[model samples]
Target chain A: MKKIYLALAVFSAVAIVIGSTVLSVSYEPLDEVAERMNLTGENLLGSPFPEYTIPGFPCWAGGIISGLVGGIIVFAIIRLLMKVGEDGGN
Target chain B: MHIPDGYLSNKVWLTCYAISLPIIAFAYIRLKRKMGKMEVPLFSALTATVFALQMVNYPLGPGGTTGHLIGTPMLAIIFGPDAGIVGLSVILFIQALLFGDGGITTYGANTLNMAITASLVSFYSYLLFRRAFKGEKGRVISGGLAGWLGIVSAALLCGLELGLSRATFGYGLNITIPVMGISHAVLGLVEGVITGFAVYAFGKYKPELFSR
Candidate 1:
């Protein structure tokens, strides 16, 4: 069961990467619409923010890496929060 | 959909913030009151997993625009609706603040659409479907359908919000609604499949997670 879960996770990851790559390079109508609608803008920090993309990697690869990193960060934060809550409760 | 900062006017975004803030506070309070300490790690882990999954964007037909999994249905199924709201809000907040995937100004709108609307819709939809069917098969089907409908519902709400912003931002309902609706409808299928498989796998492997 664990192996199956692992396999599914890997397969899903691979599929995501490949799909993202194709989508990144392909012509996106929504993006065009957004552009037409003038939805793109700067980040909250006052810096220019563009759509999801990486200079050296494909969009999918970048998404995968960033997502994993984000997950780790969130997991750590949640665990820390839990610890703090536990301490407070005690 | 991660609406950028300039996309929504102050009136629109502020209204969204006003609406979403109270709901978020309510969700937090409910989570604190209802959930045990042991559930914290599982909730956090699942939230993080959903955050990661949202990053995986698949193409919608020949258009270059991509759509990602909403994961609200799966989260709601596992942790219930309130937790789903909290989890998705956290993910969206982080993405906007740290990754700049979404705009901070428009964060409220995004939260309302994805976290509140999608979560509740998926949760209730799943419950309805689950009652209609029986056993493990029922749960899987319900989850998939919920996921699909949840995303579409969220997209529809987003379109409405965008359309409302027309007076301030100048983009009308016709433009935003159809575009968001069509793309998300297609993407919802992928969400459905993923949700179904996930429910099935989790049901088979870890029945404890489903225990309330």
Candidate 2:
């Protein structure tokens, strides 16, 4: 049973790695329209890493890397009001 | 669906942001109060899975459009709604800030749709269906149906938000709602199947995850 679970985990990991190649996207016709509709793009702290900037890197690469940093950062957060922190003590 | 920047008008975005404040507070309290050492691994694994799944987009019919598994339903069903909400919020935040999958300005609206709506809808619906059905077979079926409904609702809401921005977006409910709804209504079936399968696999392999 454990081996099966491990295999499934490994399969999933492989799938994700392969899946990374398909991440770049646009909203299609909706996207074309989004460009034309033209609402103010002003943001206080605009996207530090817009998808447009990264031409070749798969979107998940950003997610996986950011997640490492973000996950560690969130431990501090979870402590006050999330699953890892307040109610669930180490 | 990740609504990018400049899509939602200020009115629409700000309203969602305002509406989310109290919901976040409520979820925050519940999130802090639940889970223990035993629940941590499964919780973390599911969170990672959700993040992973969101990045992969599958084609939506022949329209040249695609969508990903909005994987919160399984999390909500497994760990509870609060965890789903907070967990998804964290993922969406990271996606927006770094990957540009979504917009920081539209973050509130995206969170409202994916995190709060999906979490609450799936959690309660799963409970309702599970109670009605009974047994292991019932659990799997319920998980699938609940997950399907959850994503459909989120998609419809997305359509509505985008449609509402029609004044600014040049696409009203007539255009946006049906397109979003139809695509997701189809996509929701896949969500259901995956949710049901996950429920069955976990129940068979690690029943302990459901105990708390």
* TM-scores of the candidates in the order shown: 0.85, 0.82
lDDT of 2 by residue, B22-81 (tens): 887788676655566556555665676666566556666336666678888988888789
Q: Give the interface RMSD of each candidate.
A: 4.1, 4.2
Clashing pairs in 1: A27-B63, A27-B64, A28-B63, A28-B64, A28-B65
Error of 2 at B85 (Å): 0.6
Task: Quote the positional error of residue B13 for candidate 2 in Å.
Answer: 0.8
Alpha-carbon error at B77 in model 1, in Å? 1.3
Question: What is the C-alpha lDDT profile of model 1 across A1-90, one tens digit per residue?
Answer: 346435545654654465455443433344566676565556665422233344587656666666566676777776664455556665
How does residue A44 of candidate 1 score in lDDT?
66
Please tell me which predicted candidate would have the highest lDDT against the true structure. Answer: 1
